[model samples]
Target: MNVSNLLKYCALSMAIGIAIVPNANAITPDDQLVIGMSMDNLLSLDPAAASGLDVVGVNSNLYDMLIELAPKDPSQISPAVAQSWTISDDGTRITFKLRDDVTFHSGNKLTAQDVAWSLQRVLKLNLALASTWKTYGFTADNVDQVVQAIDDYTLEITLPEITDPKLVLYTLGSSPSAFIVDRKEALKHEVDGDLAHTWLTTNVAGSGPFQLQNWRAKDRVLMNRFDDYWREPSEMKRIVMRHMTESQSLRLMLQRGDIDVAMGMSIPDIEALKQDSHIRTEANTRGTLYYVAVSMKDPKFANKKVREAVRYLIDYQGINESIMPNYGVLHQRPVKSGLPATLPGPGYALNVEKAKTLLAEAGYPEGFQTSIRVLSQLPFINIATNVQSTLAQAGINAEIITGTGNQVYGAMRERNFEMLVGRGGGGIEPHPHSSLRSLVYNPDNSDEAKLTNFQGWRTAFYSPDINSIIDTALLEKDAKKQIKMYQDVQNLYDTQIGAIFPISQMVDTVLIRSDVKHYEGHQAATTRLREVTKER
Candidate 1:
């Protein structure tokens, strides 16, 4: 299949649908972890082309980047393939000392040349992952010039004159684009100018703890431990990511011992699992967030007061405590809480009177009706329903339209929707400027721009002031002032009413059997299976 068809095939399969029950005859070894959940976001296995927090989690196990984030402390950087790195005082150049023992799954000894090649390929391909690296000032024509290998053990990266050096490392360590692949293995399979995309769509070409053993689209992704991995080998020799979408099937599989771990279960199912003696459920607050977007193209929402009123229409406490229990927290800022440069906004309170008054001031005293598109999956559909009800209480009618992610989110991306309740957050690097870019930065709304990275663009919202704040903060040298710039951006967002982040969510409730051990979620919502072992 071609590239576009391949993406459509994957998207069609991952689109929210009926849950397929796992075959009962399947058996797992004592050292194997058969995880059950809907693998929806994993489109391409190629490190250069793939994107998403789930994709990051899977690719992290397959490819070893020069650096990695300290699991517990996202603010701190840790070495992965590169033992150490140094930045130039000017904050424009960085040099990494690559590890000598690292070897690709293809049995090729990793060289600094390979590291340079992998990064350059991201620029050459210009896929979704490319945004991670492209955010730094390197372009396809100049990436080769910007990225160079000092020697077989040393790789160097040169940045723009005004770029923040820390942002480079944070982007390299956390973004999917940084996952280094085997230089030669990928080219060996290159076809039709695809840069090995056709082959890599389902193959593994990295040096992580686990290697891709098999991938049956819409069914399961089977990965096996890489014995020659540079780090300690995973205790579980294999992991099976079962393609089960329904929360009930996941809960059922966990109860019957069909799957060792069940992730992404609904709130009610998660609560019921707590009562089950055989199941152990863990809920960790992650960097993921849920927010509402008002299309600026819509005349009603174009009014700032109407947008602010919509924010107050949401019952943050009632929604989280009752409908989306443990899914998210009451956070309304553009950035995740506790991150540097993150400043709290005058959070929208649930008050029908307040909403009605704002509506009246916006010249909609009797209120109006609008359509909201959402994914027909757990939590989102439920959350949309709750939002609909709340808006109705304020005399505003919100009709809910449910569809697959491709239909709902794809529409949002194409700028074809008036309003949407979307899930997004990029706080994995602990930077407010970076996270806000995903939520509110829209330098251009032109079709030719196609700047999907900026969610604000999707909602037809654009502001030169906020966009300048994002650009300035990213390149700001002084840490304190950079944070102040971010604070200014948040304050601008509060008054302008571009988007409303009702809450930041934890994202998952993982159910594991008592035998399961050491399973924890990364801030990006990807579960690392290497440290996971069973009591047996």
Candidate 2:
């Protein structure tokens, strides 16, 4: 577990397709930040296509967004490339004045044109991240008109719909699709008029603090500091992010001082790390929620009484206490905690006898059989097993189906599942509408509508009243009234017994060496490494 021994393991891990560094004197160098994490989902460097937190962390460093969520307070916004901005009284347009000193890593001066093009490309390409923009009534065909560069330093965005402009601002600040790319440099590598989409998948073009040296999929990512960065230069000359998925191995590496930071570790390993004098563990609660969802497409779940019975069947307190130690905290409300509009937990507890009685009342004296789809991971698989045991108590024969995120959530997205234990609902923006829109806003319910992005639609759980309330709450300019409207929505959902029942709000934990300074994790997952340093 020594530094030299850990380096040898690193060399072996990189033997396949990664370049081996020679004469590596130190594992945790003062001027280099070494991170250990699972890069399985770090599939693309392309901002338009990247989907997970892994990519968000990488892109946040390699690219610049107009604005960023304040590191200390995610609810507040801070300036990045756009130093100043103004919103119209009508709440339809926003004008941004780009900072004059920024320049892309490629030496081209960063301008508002690049910003406009970057946002437009996301919609035109219509990739994974484009859905966020599409929700704001932006379309591929009209993106150029919607997002226009007024001049070299000025950009204007006109919303097609009457929505809260704060949501759009939050999207610009946090969404991966909002990262500004060097338009000229990207177009230089274009293939078949793709706007360098294919090239960007593996490479980067931005004016951020770090420049990607090389990225070996599922291996490691190497980034060198950009000395010409507009802001204070990054203290670390280089960042080496090694793809280590095993929690014990990461624990060993950290214990030996081989890695400066370790993320996505198991709860047991995380607990063990808490006892280490040289390592510190930090948990930042995110906006996303973990919930048990039932597809109303299933006749059994379509019944409100059955839905209520299923709610009573869940041991929310038990699961949150035993299984969700480092993963999440108890949160029953649909909207995430810490928001003005958010309501208190409804305190739904396990009532097996009541669930059984309700099952009988729902015309099922004998509990029916169903399958629970869940991701084959620590907390998810564990939650599903617990749910299975509880469901059996009420004579419900529940089979646990485990698979990868794609296999499990894809079934939910296609509305092809009976029941599912999943984690989602966009909470990154710190806006109440962000979570509500993703979790419960089902604008359309027809099978042909195919609004797969919304979990409400995916579960075939459509409530016109809930949808109308959400819409009104978003547009409610009066702050106090908006808060009241959101609370009312939660109350209505409680009485209606919605298909998706939230169990906990997610909390992401990371273990860093005690000497690592200024390395705060962002709740939005866009943790910038520019200010990070290590004390030798």
Candidate 3:
């Protein structure tokens, strides 16, 4: 269906009431516990438009997916709405059998139809949502069709082509692209497409364990336990999420016992938290990589030798030791640093002498000048300062520009900067296609397909051979073939197309009050309220 029709249907659906107000005294702070976090601020409450930590926090409380990552074992998926799933022989179809008992917080039964409708909504409203489908090598446009209601509990998903393991994993994660919303309820609210964007910006209704009760943007959000939650009931009756923008304020709140958990603290703050006996710290390897996306389109960086020289000049080891001493781990590959069989091979080895030679070969005997823009957020500022100092030692004159996240993202998208330092989150898929699509597949222009081509990366280095290898890897079902193809792509990325420099995938450290419990299964700073509980 066209987007206009979809919008009309959504508006009609939302007009019908889906929410059932809870008893006034059913939930209260006295019956629950509070958690604290540092949020980047949310642009919208709808999972489709969610990109920041605040948005994630809000969505995690309000929405539920068919499948969820098991808390103890992230690789072992578990049932949320869908109890079990089976793959077709050709791996082209995935059939998910929904749990019979699950219902939305609004009291409507969640069925196969809802699941199908949710996926369709994401596919239909692609731009309003995060660009996660790029990793699947299939945008929402590629979802050939979704058939459901085979007895209400069975949902069958038919893709245009064979499904890859990485795609499967991505579809089950907490990412915005995977969240399942109530179709009838969403439509009844008069929110369809972009119009629904504003409606969902601060309101929600879903099957997740927690239900949002209040949201004061840039301040705090309050959620209470969903009494009709299909699974085990949450331990805390309510959860208070205080958005303390300043790290110092968060630190003070934690010390005063005003909050139970504090997330995304700086290295120094984490170190200080360790001194308090009442606080406990947990760190996990984030599926994220910090890198400097250099503009290959620039005349100076167009040469492969120049790109290699820039990569070699980065002293990742020293930066980690000095800036992120306790929480950082050097990353060799774009994948997370701690995953099994995901390490970098000969392609990522560092060599200063080789860098100098490459620089000289690129006609930069004394290196060249470039501007590096960085987000003003903590840790990023420190990291950029370190990068500036390190590049200077290689005779490269680097200057740092600071701006807000939105400003930086816009600048990168507009190709206004020489280099941009940022992390490309959500590359959990093992295949190179997952990373390649984001960096290479530009829907707007075949020439500028890679998202990283933001800095005018149009060059002859866009190799058809590398693209073929990535495509083969995506279609390859066998694990061995996938790895080989991935290796080929990495080798190409490292040696030929010098678009990005791989930095450390540092651990995201979170501090929880000793009295709090049930916060587990976080691979990074990203947390799901469904899996967390506060001790009384």
Candidate 4:
């Protein structure tokens, strides 16, 4: 069945609910983490080409980057493949000294050359997520000259003086594009000199803790523990992730102990399971933000006053406390709180009378009717449906359009939709400038501009002043000065209504057996399996 039909079928069955089975497979193997999750598809296994949570959730098990965030704490950065590094006094050059003792799963010793090759591959192949690195001036055409393996154990890269050194490091620390792929092994599998791009999609070539055992698309994935892992191997000897999206199905699987962990559980299911003593639920306040974007291209939303009115039409508190309890927090800032460049969110709440007055001033005295496209998934469907009812109170009737994320986001990217209730931001980087640049601050809004770095381009929202402020904030090396610039941008965000932010940053929750340990959630939903252990 398609997403719509599948969800309907799942909902109907959910009403009947599954009974507690006798053999709830309660005793998971002491050496496995069988995770249950939701995904439309796992497009590619090549880390460079991967974008969604499906791939990111477990890629780290097979790859190691030069630097990475602490699995338990995103606020701090930790060395991975690189033991130590130093930056030039001018902050334009960085040199990393690698760990010679590490070896890839292929039995090939890790080398600095592999690092250079991987970085260049991302730019040359122009992978799906290359834009994240483009912001720091590293491109395929100029990479050889910019990134060099100074020796067998040292790697070096230089940035344009105008680029922020921190931004470059941040991108590298974020994903596998900056990781070391076994060049010798990768080249052997290369077809048509594709840098093994075609081969690696279904293979593993790294020094991380796990190896890709098998992958049957639309069905399941199996990763086996690497005995020769450079670091201490995880207690999990195998990880089995079945392709399951229905929240009810996932909850049932967890309750039956058919799976050790259940991700993407709906709020109602989570609350209901709270009474089940055998299961554990954790809600982590992540950096992800959920919001509604009003297309500036639409004449109805072109007025700033009308956009501002849209913010007050919905009950932020009611939704967080009732509809989204533990799922999301009431955050009104464009950049979520605690990240660099954020300010405490202030007074934007449900004021239906005020919203009606603003609508009248904008010449929509009788209010207006609009439509929003959303994914056929939890939180979004519920959030949009609730917002629709709230908006009607202000005389603005919003019709909810339910579909896959591809359909909804695709429409936003083409500027083909008037509004969208979607969830996305620079939640992974934990930086204010990253969120602001990705969500707002569009200076060049033309077809020729091709600014995928700015989502505002998708919404047709342009603000040159805020754009300049964002650029300024990014370049400031002084932490204090940079944060102040972000605050200034947030102030503009609230006044200009550039985008409507409903929740500060939402969290990801998972239901697991109580014996599972160290299964913390990350903002990107990129859960690392290496550190996870199970109690006897």
Candidate 5:
């Protein structure tokens, strides 16, 4: 049979509505984009507090950063609200020249003060996104003094410590915390001294292409195109993001033309759709990693030999081949793949006998029982099941505990979990430090530090040596020396058997209608909808 005939045959066999009469729920093309994906991790819309890829995608359309990492080439920085910027010879200060033409959705003129205040709000609030700035030595006390507006269209930032100016620039262009908020509008709704923290949870004060019409938590988010946008208005008249958790439902909706885009679909469903002529799948590899982490607070896991045993228990080859297709590729390193500084993975493979011997050496010859906290979603649950099976071979009985993103990660944030199957580590910025900062560099190991932003801290895994290496690497001016220093950090991490073991590098796959034009998925999760349009 021809490809078209096969598609029809397959659709008819499945009795999908698209083969006959479309469902009433099917959306008709009206210059609007309808997307289906899970919103469980979308806890906060406030740029300072929002913590997941869902909110990052949402905020991309709702706010504009000073600069942007070009979607086409993330290595290249693209100007947005800021027209141009210059770094001081000492590499301690950066001055940005703002565009005079930009205005917020509230019709307030975008200015340097707005940029300064928006950045300051992050440190002042000290929320989830403040970790990055804090690492750069900016604090609530120093923020006002360092990040200031020299004039209405000129913003200046003085780094509180000696570090790469590019890191700060990358943070400004890519981090959601760097997105500029309308200072005047936010202050108008400020309750007490929150800087509109409460209001911004569900509202927006941005200069991006779309304005939030309504955001019903865990249900749907509706946004309309901002007609007075600085650039060409979004081709989409409105964007509707329906809160969908089921991959099967998303696949069905996409097959029936009910939604223009579907994210977070199951591998089987995604593979099934590849034959459908009307749909196409786009896979974008992000900087994040899917890792199996252990808390060092647990005496059993704190042992270096035990950590190595746990590493040997993972079936890296099997998982990447059978379980990680369309999800991720085998990457057994802290830093993500493809970066110039990122060394090849240590090439650790699953060796059940080796794990058994290591366990015996660690005085766990009979193995032990533990619990693994994992997100209750596709890829995660599947990966956990595989890990559980492999761990059982080494006599480690791990009870699988599943929950939503908030539940699983919240436990990790509280330093309350024994083991976890999770995905994290920054990939938004092109810099190698991005991943190391999130996954390896832990300045504080004490629980009192409450440095929940760093997964390294969350795992209670700290090496002063590793931290020092990272600090020195960031300040190194020579390109070759910096790369060598990063490699040395990874070598030390492997030798020390860090608490977190990378299994695979993340690859986000989304299915979209063939006619959905200009929908580019970003490695940073900041996929913009401004230029997206539907041919139908």
Candidate 6:
């Protein structure tokens, strides 16, 4: 597709409007306790349709799922609406024992039927939220069937095959895979034939600790504590998320005590803020992989040797030091550390001579020129510029094309660019099988299917042999066996996959007001607002 066509599609996709104000004066009353955030951009407010971190952070407070990750430690799955769960001997079936006391914000009692309906809705919305499934190789199709309530508190789910350990982890944790919504209320505002799935784009009804009170689109989103929430009530009565896109303005707000919390501040600015006595800094290794996706559809990147050479040209250590200093760590596997079995092994090593020779063999002895698309966010832009410098040393002339996060994604979907620098957030799953499948697996003629060919960069297409291995990995019940199977898939990605240039895991530095208490971080780039309470 051409640039004009791509732009037209982007305009259509984002009809919601960009009402963000970067330098607005402090508007919230001092008694209300407002939090300021420097956001990348919110793509959608609908929980099922949300794909970005900013959108997820906001929606997480609005929606509750059947199962939730423990706030203090993400490795364990804790009860939310469900009191407990059970698995079949073959691991093909999962039975959830629900909590009878929980109720949606609308006051309807939570039921087993609601859980079944919610899973079905998630499957239908998977197409629109393909990126959410990339890390776990999960799709709506994995759910072979759903069995309704044996009683008001019990629900059962059966898979077509034995599910892998990572797939199980994803099923229990990923927001897109497990978040539960109210079926009865969602169906009242149905878009197409599916009410639960359709109504989610603009509306929500959940049993979480907080409930969505109002949304002013790009301007602000307000959520209030759920008085009858299933869990203990939050200390804060209301959470007001104001959209700010400028780092300088956010820094000023943090300094002036206008916001209790600030997100996405620049690295240098965060360091400077740490010196202040009133502010406290918290950082965590968010399981995210930042990399470049080169369009393999382009003839220049069609060769395996050429792609491998590009990987060698990148200085992972230098990029981490210069661009991410305190907020990033070089990643050896696509899977981030702190998760299970993500130990370092041989992948790409920096070798300038190898890159030079490979370029020469590809008929670009003096190097060829290409443009890489990047988001306006500081970390992404810095990485892209650093890549340009690295590639230049290997005789390749590369230019950076900067745009909004949505704009850059739009260009990537249309295959209108040669390369794009971006980050792919990992799910709680400890394997790369899901991540690889999402990026490479083709499902009908969907955009995900089209993009799955890695923009046509794979030296050799995904074969039946690889496909069968992935299918087997998904079914393996043993934890050790599952990890072994995933390692096999990672071997294939490290040797032959197209589009991705694996780099590093994300470490986000968050600044919070010293008075804020009970802050708990998530593996994804989020924190539980329900746990936070300000000192009087």
Task: Specify the highest-lDDT model's number.
Answer: 5
lDDT agreement of model 6 with the native: 0.65
Give residue 315's error in model 4 in angstroms: 2.1
Off by over 4 Å in 3: 1-30, 52-54, 128-131, 134-144, 147-151, 189-195, 338-341, 344-369, 394-397, 413-416, 425-461, 524-526, 531-536
> What's the TM for model 5?
0.94
Against the true structure, whose TM-score is highest? 5
* lDDT value, residue 44 of candidate 5: 86
RMSD of 2: 3.3
**Clashing residue pairs, backbone N/CA/C < 3 A, model 6:** 136-434, 137-434, 164-474, 296-456, 296-457
Clashes (candidate 4):
1
Report the lDDT tens digits of candidate 3 across residue range 463-532: 5666677667777768787777766666666657556676766566778777666677355223676555
Per-model clash counts, in order, read 1, 0, 12, 1, 0, 5
- Candidate 1: the clashing residue pairs are 328-505
Candidate 3 C-alpha error for residue 199, in Å:
2.0
lDDT of 1: 0.77
Instruction: Give candidate 2 regions above 4 Å deviation.
Output: 1-26, 188-195, 447-450
All candidates' lDDT scores? 0.77, 0.87, 0.63, 0.76, 0.89, 0.65
Ranking by lDDT: 5, 2, 1, 4, 6, 3
lDDT by residue (tens digit), candidate 4, 89-150: 98889999999888988899999999998888887787556666666766778989999999
lDDT of 1 by residue, 1-536 (tens): 35653443344224322223333322345777877766665667788767655567677777888987776677788888899999988778999999999998889999999999988988888765565565676778999998999999999999844667887888887777777878899899998877788888889888888888888765777778999988889998887777777887677657756678877788888888899887887766666588777777789888988988888888887777776775776777878777767775465678889989999999999999899998776777788888899899888998899875557877876778877887876757677767777788877778666666567777778889988888888877788988899899888887788754546555566788877878877675434678988875
CA displacement after TM-score superposition, residue 141 of candidate 6 (Å): 7.5
Q: How does candidate 2 score on lDDT?
A: 0.87
Q: Write the per-residue lDDT of candidate 5 for residues 1-536, one digit (tens) a residue.
A: 35654454344324312223443433435587888888878888999988878899999999999888887578798888899999999999999999999989999999999999999999999887898899999999999999999999999999999988888988887788988899999999999999999999999999899999999887788899999998998778888888877887777778777678999888789999999998999999999999999999999999988999999999899999988999999999999888888888788998999999999999999999999999888789999999999999999999999988889999999999999999998777777889999999899898787777899999999999999999999988899999999999999999999999999999999899998889999888999999998775
In model 2, the Cα lDDT at residue 439 comes to 86
Candidate 1 regions off by >4 Å?
1-27, 353-369, 394-396, 475-480
